[model samples]
Target: MSVNESNPRQLKLLAAVRERGAATVEELAQLLDVTLQTVRRDVQRLAEAGLLARFHGGVRVPGSTTENIAHGQREALNAEGKSRIARAVAGEVPNGCSLILNVGTTAEAIARALLRHSGLRVITNNLNVAGILAANAQCEVIVAGGTVRSRDRAVVGETAVDFMRQFRVDIAVVGCSGIEADGTVRDFDLREVKVAQAILAQGREVWLAADASKFNRLAMVQLAELSRFDRLFTDAPPPAPFPDLLERAQVRCVVAGADATGDPTP
Candidate 1:
């Protein structure tokens, strides 16, 4: 295989990492039906090119940056993927159910998808989500009280976390900056993480929504583990170890539709 960016093998490697979130050398080799050395070399080239991140034993889609991405940039990152994920997640949530939505572009997408649903009591830390749901008179939108971060219109602080503990909802839809290979969810801000944590805790069934770009990104705080989610909805399948890890964790991964490689729709 040509070890360049245009090489089919390299492209496949990137896609696999993005799907699975992360994959070890052995896992990548098996997935590509290539030798371990070839996988390593491809990973090395991709890492050097700034397309992926190489860790101790595997490669993952690179995280955007050490800091949080600007809200506008995040909305533009994987617009279609987030839309697909939101639709899939929305399918699982019935009308008239109580929900807690954390702050993120993907979470905002979920809110948009839920606009047609009636009798939804949405508790959210995102002003954007609140505004979208508020337009639907049938839906009761509850905004968390806290210091609003102007960058993303996210409400965070002790008050937000405390507010989240007041009600146990039917579902929790959350987004993350990154997903670790070992099933850990990540975020850049500690305050946001706290509110996310509280939201996760208050939901009976947790669903994590993220686009393929979220795989392999590094965030400063660990929000929760993949095990905490009852289901993970995304635009594509996750990498090797994640399939096994999700199985062990009993977390179902719902693919939105035909993936980039023309994989069959779910």
Candidate 2:
């Protein structure tokens, strides 16, 4: 069967791979209630189209720059945790100030949280964030000009990086795909990482917002070390060496819905 057919089985297969990160052929067959042969055929087609990857025993979703899931999928990944993190971050931002934001689902959540604040200037490379904040007439939204990635509406490349160099803001809001044990933040796209780096450099104080799942994930490009951020808002405390690293770096860590080292509550 064709991968682009939009049939129920193929769609379900895609969803399954996205949910589990990776799946064996047998797993997909059972999960989709399809024959092993049918599963293999569908996997072959999807892999050919660069939607997924083929390994010895299974097919896996592509976590690389080109094949990452749509923004909508990311928004649904950790909805509640992101919202809480957003609220905490919103509390940290004042009514009248300049802020820089970058591309990521968590950054989008922050945009929604900032809607009520007035007299704020927001510069971003995320088209989604620009749109979400544009509704606030009091908040000035500045979008970077660059190559707009069709898959996720993320603005990246050198133009985006250069665009971010013009301002030193009060705070920077950013997100990443993974947080390493060494306290490094990482993402799958090097181009996007460059833009993030530029944004970080232009901000007086940087705030990183990521869900706990990032602790267990890995990505190809390094954004920055946790030391670069003044504060980190997350759903849970990081595991292992990270806790000590953050303490040493003096980075305030805010855990959503829980009291921790950096709770923003009054």
RMSD of each: 6.8, 7.6
Candidate 1 displacement at residue 85 in angstroms = 0.7
Please state the error at residue 145 of candidate 2 in Å.
0.6
lDDT by residue for model 2 over 127-205, one digit each (tens)?
9999999999999999999999877789999999999998899998899987767678888888999999999999899
Which residue pairs of candidate 2 clash?
none
Stretches > 4 Å off in candidate 2: 1-67, 258-266
TM-score for each of the candidates: 0.76, 0.74
lDDT of each: 0.81, 0.80
Segments of candidate 1 deviating more than 4 angstroms? 1-65, 258-265
Question: Model 1, clash count?
Answer: 5
**Which consecutive 10 residues in model 2 have the weakest lDDT in total?**
257-266
